[model samples]
Target: MSSAAIFVNIFALSCLVISLIKDRAKTKQSLLVAVKSFFRILPIVLIIIIFIGLLLGFVPLDLISKTMGEQAGFGGVILIASVGAILHIPALIAFPLAASLLKGGASVAAVAAFITTLTMIGTVTLPLEIKELGKKMALLRNGVSFIFAIIIALIMGMML
Candidate 1:
C-alpha cells in the first residue's frame, strides 16, 4: 500500500480511538451515524461503479482518446465541459469517473474542464437557483462559470 494510504488509515484509527476514550457513548453514537450514512450512500456508489464499468467495457478506447485526447484540443475540452455542466452527479462520485477517464486516455484539459464545469455550474439545479436567486442572476452566474471553466482547463492543459 502507498505510504499516504497507510498514513490516512493510521490517522483515522487514532482519531476514532481518541474519540472513544473521550466519550464512549458519543463515540458509539457517532459510529452508528457514520455506518448509517455509509449504507445510505452505498447504493449510489455501487450504481456509479457499475456504470463506469459498463462505460469502460463498451466504449472503445480509441473513441474516448479521439474525443478527449490531445488531438481533440479546445473543441473537445469545450464539449466535455458542456456535458459536465449538464450532469447532476455529486462531485464525490465524479472523482472516480474522472480518474477512470484519465486512465482511459482523456487529455488533462478535457478532464479538468469536465470536473470544473461539473462542480461550478449546475443545469439540473438551475430551476431552483432561478427561483431562489432570480433568473438573471442564475443565468449570469452559469454563463460566467462556463467561461471560467474553459479558461481553467486550458491553463491546466498548458501546465501539465
Candidate 2:
C-alpha cells in the first residue's frame, strides 16, 4: 500500500479507538449504521466496477486514444463532458474510471472534464431538479456547471 493509504488507515483506526473509549454504545451503533450503509451501496458499486472493467477490457486503447488523446483537442473534452453529464454514476466510481481513461491515453483535459461534469451536472436527474429548483435554476446550474467543467478541464490540460 502507499504511504497515504497507510496514514489514512492509521488515522481511521485512531479515530475509531477514540470513539470507542468515549462511548462504546454510540460507537457500536455508528458501526452498525456504517456496515448497513456499506452493504446497501455494495451492489451498485460492484455493478459499476464490473461494467467499467468490461468497457475498458473490450474497448480498444487505440480507439480511446483517438477519441480523447491530446490530438483529439477540445472536441474530445466536449464529448466526454456531455457523456459525463448524462450518466448517473456516483462520484466514488468516477475516480477509477478517470484513472483508467488516463492510462488508456485520454488527454488530461478530457479526463478532467469527465470528472467535473460527472460530479457537478446531472442530466438524468434534471427533471427532478427542475421540479424542485425551478426550470430556470435547474437549467442555469447545469449549463454553468458544463461550461466551468470544460474550462477547468482546459486549464488542467495546460497545467498538467
**Considering every candidate listed, which one attains the maximal TM-score?**
2
The global C-alpha lDDT for each of the candidates, from Candidate 1 onward, is 0.94, 0.93
Q: What 10-residue stretch in candidate 1 is worst by lDDT?
A: 87-96
User: Which residue ranges in model 2 land beyond 4 Å of their true spot?
Assistant: none
Model 2 TM-score is 0.87
Instruction: Give per-residue lDDT, candidate 1, residue 133.
Output: 99
Error of 2 at 117 (Å): 0.4
TM-score of each: 0.83, 0.87
Task: Report the number of the highest-lDDT candidate.
Answer: 1
After superposing all C-alphas onto the true structure, candidate 2 shows an RMSD in angstroms of: 2.0
